[model samples]
Target chain A: MSRRARAGVESRIDAPAGDGAPGGSGPGWPPWACRLAGVAIVVHLSALLAGVMGVAPASPLERAAMEWFGPYHAFFDLGYSYRFYIEPPPTPVAVATLHFDDGRPDETVRLPAREIRGPRMRHQRELALAHSLFVDARQAKEQTGDISQSRLARSYADRICQIRPGCEMVVWRVVQHLIPDRDQVRDALDSPGAGRFDLFDDSLFATPEWIGDFPCHGR
Target chain B: MPRPLIEIRRYLAELSVSTRAGWNRFFFAPADPTALGLIRAAVGLLAFWSLLVMGLDLDAYLGSGGWESAELAWSSLRPFAWSFWFLVGDAWLRPAWIGCLVVLLFFTLGIFSRTTSVLSWMIVVSTVRRAPAALFGFDQIVSMLLLYLAATGASGQAFALDRYWRRWREAKRTIRAIPARYRKDGLGRAVEPDTPGLPAATVSANLALRLIQIHLVMIYAIAGLAKLQGVSWWNGEAVWRMMATGEFVMFDFTPLARWPMALSALTHGSLALELVYPALIWPRLTRPIMLTGVACLHVGIAVVNPGLSEFALVMIAANLAFVPGLYVRRLAIAHEQPAVRVLFDGACPRCRGWMALLTAADPCHVLAAVDLTAVDVRTVHPALTEAGCLKAMHAVTASGRVTAGFDALRAILLRLPLFWPVALLGYFPGVAWAGRIGYNRYAASRPRDVPCTDSVCGIHSRTSPPAARDRSRSHAPNNATAIQEDS
Candidate 1:
């Protein structure tokens, strides 16, 4: 065999230390360091597993594991639930309209713009903020029977007011733009811009539901 | 002792010893550092890009009065959650951001890498924690990779400027000490300098890769299991729903609106890929197929949703842990070392012979010989004149640095690993000056296939030598592009 092929084979082999591997390890670790590292690895892996399993629909054991390991996960920012596209994505998108006091025109901003063509992360970031507000609203409604009392919604509005210097108050609302089923798509096939079907149809969106209204700090 | 009790005790003891050994082999086996270095460079670049984009609107997302106020963010933090942004006053925010960017730049370049990697990770964590409302999977994966890089401590050992600088310094030091050592020993033989080779394998490198691989498995398994709880995923409508969603959709999938079977197939294929990935990726025979499936899946996701491109790229990069370090090392070399193109006179037989030798020496194909006659010389560089190239050979580096005659030869030699010693010797105090003079004389005497009536020939010789020009060999040069085009 050629030298290159031989080196490749040597690299692949799980030989003992100092066996002339391509990237050879000189000597094995001391027993004390090995034992300490082994313990650390075990703990870290266990914490990671617990954090992942602790999302909704978890078992009792998983929940208990998370309770014990939650602090470590939070500190290191290793607490990923990995619930990506687990369910049908939510149809309703939240948006806020800003009202100005200093003769600036009233502006409306969608969390994720309808047609985000550039720097799409800006849209994703905005979408995350809006989703947080929606979650807060839902939780508040469930707990106190009033979605307007959501603290996150108020904080969001207040922050917006600060961003727009002359803004007096901000209004938050949720608009449902549900995805069309196959039948709906077929029905709208002959409509204008049929290739996009009802993607741009104004009637696709339901009436916006008011979440909250909050006044600016100074004003 | 009772016979049964003694037998049970021996069985337990054997199992304990075997398990401990297995754990040590799995986690502490020495592995190549090139893989970690590759991961570090990629993750560092991504981190830099992430932070740069975030900096575009720093005041809005991270400012004290912007999205999440200081009080609001502080109140929502988990007990141990911390951020430098919390303590920075309004006046210091930009300065702090500039400092983070500088550290991230150094980390990406692998300069002061050990310290920069740690600092870069801390910066990412602080920014992400500071503005929790504006993060996605991209931020999380970058942070995870950075954490591993910092832990490895050998992430800058390969495909790094640090490695090159260290090697150069060591070579210089050895060169300086050679005379002193030779005089002390009074030896007849020359001393051989200690040439740096591939980075040594370390337990830390193995530990980092194993951790990343295990973490990836966990992520995929959990994601796949979580999908089982959704009605759309069960009914195979998940793919259609994602494509139909206006916010995430990139193209008009209305054409596929009537084709539910195709959509269902895609949906089921994705779900199956994710569910089987964690289990199949561990086996030697199945690892390649699993990784390919992941690449295809993530690429499709990115195409369908451009916003998730960063997230998809990070996921693909994380999967590099399963790839062997040797293959990654080859890729690192190919990517890190840019090709040096040597512009030579295709009409000169001596130059073609020289080109053939250079090509033979370059097993890695780092040198590309561009025939001046095959294409417009001006296209390569507007300043390049055919007559000047014919007078003295020229080489252009990847960064557009041009050198001529002996310097060009030195540049080419530096790229060919086999001729590194000769290249280094040429760099000595008076060797290059003498070499340049020798090269000029050689160029003046060399024969060209073109006639002496040509304007370029008049500069070298006032009259032609007593021989007819070989027109047939003039256009037919044996360089990289000639054989393919002519034959």
Candidate 2:
């Protein structure tokens, strides 16, 4: 036989100790060690099988525990508005007209021709009168030309544009006689701008006397 | 009819020898010792890397927010709790970076390999336990294997600082033992006495190897049985399910899945194979078939599974058990020598008895004995005198040198299966002196005419010598005398 083949035969005949004939004792282990090893192997295999089957309770418990220890509400997605401007139109000089609208407390007013700095002009009479009446009755005495209703609306729109670039204006006609610098007009402007905007649908606006009761008036 | 039986016996002997030789050549013939060394180096590097990684954030893997954070049913004993404390004290409590430095030293040096293994295992286990949410089977297998290596004392062998230290100690001992006369010699003497060598540690090593082989077989048998016992595995659907899972879906099992019914049948057959593997190892006819099936199964597992390379390697090692012994001896002779010729008696009863004893002693060593009276000794060895053959046992060494009597026995012992232990005994101080005295005593006790029945003398007596038998009987001491001598 070839040398290689002959050597293979020798190794087989001289099989390593413990690797004796079949049914013979294996290595250093006795029957008991084999039994113990067998049991351990079985248990480990069972556990592995259970894990593979997703039947292991440890998996779920582990996930729950992880979630509990991790940061709370750390990964969820909140959606409020920034008020930009407020404007009051200048007074119109036709019949010294006074227009009262529904207004509430904390209402801000802007005048196109004047700059009222801080509290010096806080709650000023002219701005308040212009905001409440839409046309200032005191301005009629100082006017040298007739002021049409269309001209009053145009002046309001122009003042809104100067103070707040994107502001819109709507005009409302009232049956009451025009009043100049009245306390009622001051009260109407000082209340708040809850339902004072005439651009809103009629159902959305409240009467001037009822403006103080509107929910939107609170700060 | 008698001739055929003799032929059968001869064929069986030859077959046994050939098979063993084939296996030995296949395994050890091309072995690159360097490959084993490289494997050791790789493992060491891996250990060092793991140690470095563990040191970077030891605390992150410990305490309430760490591995201990996860509450496992089996974690109540809290085996890793001590390991965590060690890490914490070493890393956070100690001044500077002593903890990592110490771990790195242990890993690199492989000192206290078992302890390092235990510590590393605990840390890895604790980490895995803590982050059971992670899906890394490779890490788990690596950790477990590392733990096994540590527990099993694999580091005792190679590529460790331990081995280097042992070698250094051995070298120092050798140097110390050198004779002063030899050391002081101005020039090498034309003829110098043979230097005695250190005792071979082969026997103890072989013992350890045997234990490992046994353990390896147990693992295989148990693993096979376990797989066979599972209903899902028996039905083959377990494999299918494993393949179907997202984590295991890397393999394209679509084609196999298409024929689940056929695949399930194949699985059942596999289960049967595994369950019967232990039984198959015994029967000569079935051994080859079973071994082939096992090899294929392991190969299939390797292909279909991740982190099964170690398992495959171990299984292949275990398969070496199937080899026989006579063939191994023949290969050892062919590669290292021509053939071992043993001269023995055919008619002498005592000679036959000794032959049986030697046969059992050196199961792996190739041997052939011829009756000195029946054959011409010169054909095999032209130098062997008939008078020398008749006087004592003789063996020719691998170098074509003749050794006789006790020396011949020692040489034969060296070549035997698992004979390293006995062979190593020959290297002890004054062992040769003792052996020479023993052989002399034994040779002196031999009967001149007839082989004695008692243990005191004679190897064999001629079969048809009635007068010699009568003389032997008369020479035999009475029962009373024998008893008195024993006393």
Candidate 3:
């Protein structure tokens, strides 16, 4: 055989670290490259596929990575990049009201969703938590006919106190008909009078300590 | 009547082989070292800059009493228990930050390329995790780039001080190995020449570049698909919404109300380019165009949108992989080293075609071609006469060595590291005989239109007069072409 052909056979036999089988990456290509690339392609594609197949394997990992890394998860995981925004039809808007009993200015602290801070993912986490708390409060009102004694109401009221010092009363409420008319201009979407208060179920949370002789405490 | 089933089976086998060959080429082709070197330096600098930026408010960011207190940082982590900050106390924060910076500096310099690359990537992840609230586009991309960079070896190919240090080591070793030879500097003491080693291209670098390329595709594909689901992207209100948002508004785009179409196109065009990127970037012909378009897209985003912040810059930096290593090598090395201008018969389509690929594939664009078909080859080359042009393919090196035929091919291949092995094989007697026979065959198989094409011109065929025209010598030049494929 020609020397060139002989060297080819030798290179194949040796199969050095950078040199794979014949016709592997070019003669100069790293030997470990093809397999590494293959593994990566297979793993990344499988993650993407599982993400598509309703996340049998990837979903758990995706959720874990998200909780761990938040916005940084996209660096480690592969699913959330293509996730679309499908929020439940806006329920008036979930708002948290903080009522101070030590009597300061009448302050209504809107749910954390409205006040976005830092990265979008952080804001997203805040919204998701607020929505969960809002849902739990509604379920409690449906069950007990009152939100003041609800566990979520008390815990959430405590958090509000932590977030804002010396706060006494906190109430969570939803204004019905939050999505504006199709024909309405963009500027009108956030207008104060755009939606009506669901007075009967609007009060989602309040401080449990001061049920007061105050008439508005339960309402 | 042909055997249809048997023929179909044969065709499928051929197709399978062809595809396998292509797959091998894609995954294993000896990657250009210059390209990897370029990517390494670029990625390293970005890492250095990023890591340095991370330390700007390190004490405040990771300190016990700053914006993110230790308690808040730990609680924010929840069940995911991983962080550099959690392990290190407040007193060690500055020291840790400094250590991270030193490692990043070494990484960027390619001192201990892969080791420092991994260390830097770890630091990036640790720092990012410590302050999730502070994370943005730049932080995410830097981490991703570092992860990919860690997978490859010898990212510091060209323009790295590591090359100088490596050569100094190699030179010292050579001086020691050669006890009899007196090597010295101007002081006349034994020493190695300061010339650095040729950009040491490696397979690892190729694989790394490919990985980055693949990862970029996935990012674009996912991002494009996600945008497709958004109502604003479809309604053309996406740009308007972006403009209206206080968080994203960089340049004053309020005038977009009057030129709504321009605003809509800007938003929609970005999505359109991203959707097409993964699909079109695979084909070689479209690869450059797609890479260029995406690069511009990022530049536009950086200029007009700027919301992704470091995301745009990091992506543009990553896209450097597609810039073609041969071209980069040509830019970096062609000036520092000797180059040869080639003289070829441009009338030969096969020759011109190979020349085009060689030119395109050449990492160092040092090969200047002067077509003998149109002009007097001597006028441009100065050394070569018309007889030399007819003798074989020739090139005049910068030192003005007029090389011809297989030797000429060897000289060109010598300059390209990928083709150096092919050139070395030509030195073997058996290979040399086969190659000469092959070159003569192609040279003899003229299209039969040239003036005085026979007689002395076809001296190799003079042994077996004209009727058969050296049928046995036919595949020789093909081997020669194969030899130069690395170039």
Candidate 4:
């Protein structure tokens, strides 16, 4: 194409020549279209604000706004609460012990197994799965029932039974790994270089809370 | 009209006009799609990697017999959320997974970008929806980015095969019409030719980038505000707490316990940076500081929390939203081929015209052209003689290897987006031999340069063709003398 024609095309696409918020005039959509788009943008921004605000520990007003904008968030799959490290809780992990139907030794499996060799992203997925088991436990506690009876746990146990064909039964529990305070770490370690206190010390863990036990059958 | 009533009417009119103009500038003002294209390419690759990893445990994660049964996972999505995996049987699982991977690969490569980007997003959403139990912050950020990229529909305008294909087609047509143009006008009227700068800009590109920027600000604001509710964040123990968490920790952070003050600083600094980012990021002055702070915070998290490394990478990628398109375009170009220097005979108008075409074709800015006539050719490389450079083009590659003649042209074409197809063809068996012979003949056929002592030579020198003038001007002062000489 000729340079002038190309330059004309480019100039047509140039941003408005001005500063922020008050005025910036350029060739653009007609007034009505701009107004229509402005309204849509306002609504979408409001929905985004409400979606974040509606995360738990929210006030009644935020909750109501979220409810109003629920469909928008749901459709876009934008249910991000953005609550990174908020009220950080003790780490919860599921430990599964498999007993084989054959004359094989029992094997222990962690849902987010440290031995789950691969990319950290894959490990992160396993961690999320482990978290679901913990979520199941938390929900069970809220409802004052056995975690084994929860649908998540049942489905999880069933899947475990189906996959490890040799396994006759599967038993799993949720354990919370508590973070020791500064004082506790200082007291436990003999010196800065001492091996006395490791971050993974077994003493920092809560007792394992049983989630479920299931016998493997060809479902 | 009364004075007060007239004043009120004027005020209202001004407000209305300003508001309309501001709205158009913010959302509808056109921007180069380079930044959005960068994001699309990155997010597409991330999505591809993410889906590929899921394939490792496809049966265990998305299969009907997987960790969470399809029935249960599908049922939980309820009325609003949907996934193609919900309907796929065990038999179709691998095929569906492979298809999504193929689409994502194309999206990453910018092949049929507009359609593939949407498909890539759909595939991402479907996969995430189906395997919700496997989600983390990575999923959230990836989804958000994909939404904006797909919405823009112009993400393929820069650094994409879609763009390359379009330009390639234009070049093909232009080449085909050249003979006809020559037939029409002896040498054809030498009008100004197109040279590369930024890609075409559009309102959709602006809107997409704006949406991503706003969304990222909201994320930071929300995350920061949410952290304020916790005692750990207030006391500067949150970072330590996260470090000590078993599932996420890559290395034991117990030694960090001794450096509580440093921990506190990190904790407080992260919180403060997040809190201020939404406000500070809009200003040009504070944007770099905020982006640096963000990189540090996320990279720190990634180092300590390996499981959340993907999340950290996603957050860093999202922050690119705040970066200007010009910088992103330059960065993308610089990354493609940073160390190739082309030595050309600047005195030759034909050579200068060829250089003009090359510079226009090279969106990546891969070649750094050094004029053979302007400098001591030996200074560029001990091996480079002025006579050798004048005879054929020479290119010094990143590895310090020198290529000449057809090989040099082929090397240059490999880096230019439009010439990749032709360049690839030169690599086929005996094609290089034929190409080298053809290049030698063409070089030999060019008229030799001679000093202007007659009206014919003077006219030819003065004409200097439009492309030669433009190309020579982009070089050193000596090139002006080169432009005055006849060929």
lDDT (tens digit, per residue) of candidate 3 on B1-487: 4799889999999889766665655556565555556666666676666656556656545665443456655665534345677788878988988888888888777778768888877887777667654555566667767877775654765545566466555545543333244222111112333342344445566666776776677778766776776777887666565544332334654444556577668778878888899877765567678878888877765555454545666788787766655465544455644387777654343454445434433433457666554455667667777556755678788887887777788777776554657889998879877887787577655331122343433433323234332431332233223222422
The DockQ for candidate 3, computed on C-alphas, is 0.06
After superposing candidate 2 on the true structure, give the runs of residues whose Cα lies further than 4 Å from its correct spot: A1-219, B1-64, B67-75, B78-82, B85-161, B168-232, B258-270, B277-299, B307-487
Docking class of 2: incorrect
Stretches of candidate 3 off by over 4 Å are: A1-37, A48-219, B1-16, B63-81, B171-197, B305-307, B330-487
* Candidate 4 clash pair list: none
Q: What is the TM-score of chain A alone in each candidate?
A: 0.79, 0.20, 0.43, 0.78
| Whole-model Cα lDDT of every candidate shown, in order | 0.74, 0.40, 0.56, 0.74
Q: Deviation in angstroms for B459 in model 4?
A: 34
DockQ of each: 0.38, 0.01, 0.06, 0.31
Q: Residue-wise lDDT of candidate 2 within B1-487, one digit each (tens)? A: 6999999999999888765554332222211111122222344444444434444534323333332232221243232222244334323533423453465356445566556655555545444444332213223333434444444444333234454444444433432332232222111110111221111212222332333333334444544554644556754565554433222123555345446676677666656666677566545567679778888877766565433443444454345435332232344434553246676433233444455444433322355555554456676577886557655667765567777777776777667533557767987889977987787566544443333354433333323267866654454324312322442
lDDT of 1 by residue, B1-487 (tens): 9999999999999789867866877778776666677778778887887777777778867888767767777888897878888988888988988888889888877899899988988899888888887888899889888888887676786556676556545544543443244332121111111433566777777778888888999989988988988888878789888888777766788778678798889999999999999888876668889999999999998887777888888899888878876665465334444467788765455665566556544434566667665556687777788678878989987777889999999989988654677999999999999999999998877765554555566555533243443333333224322423443
Q: Give the runs in model 4 whose Cα sits over 4 Å from its true position.
A: A1-27, A30-32, A101-105, B1-17, B179-197, B332-361, B364-393, B396-487
Name the candidate, 1 or 4, with the larger DockQ value.
Answer: 1
Candidate ranking (DockQ, best to worst): 1, 4, 3, 2
> For model 3, how does the per-residue alpha-carbon lDDT over A1-219 read when each residue is reduced to its tens digit?
986996465444222222222212334535465666767666655554444333223467565544444333444523334332212133323455666667877666544344444443333333333445556556667888775444444544544555566666666555432322222323333456744222122232332222112122343
Clashes of each: 0, 35, 22, 0
Q: lDDT (0-100) at residue B468 of candidate 3? A: 30
DockQ-superior candidate, 2 or 3: 3
Specify the highest-DockQ model's number. 1
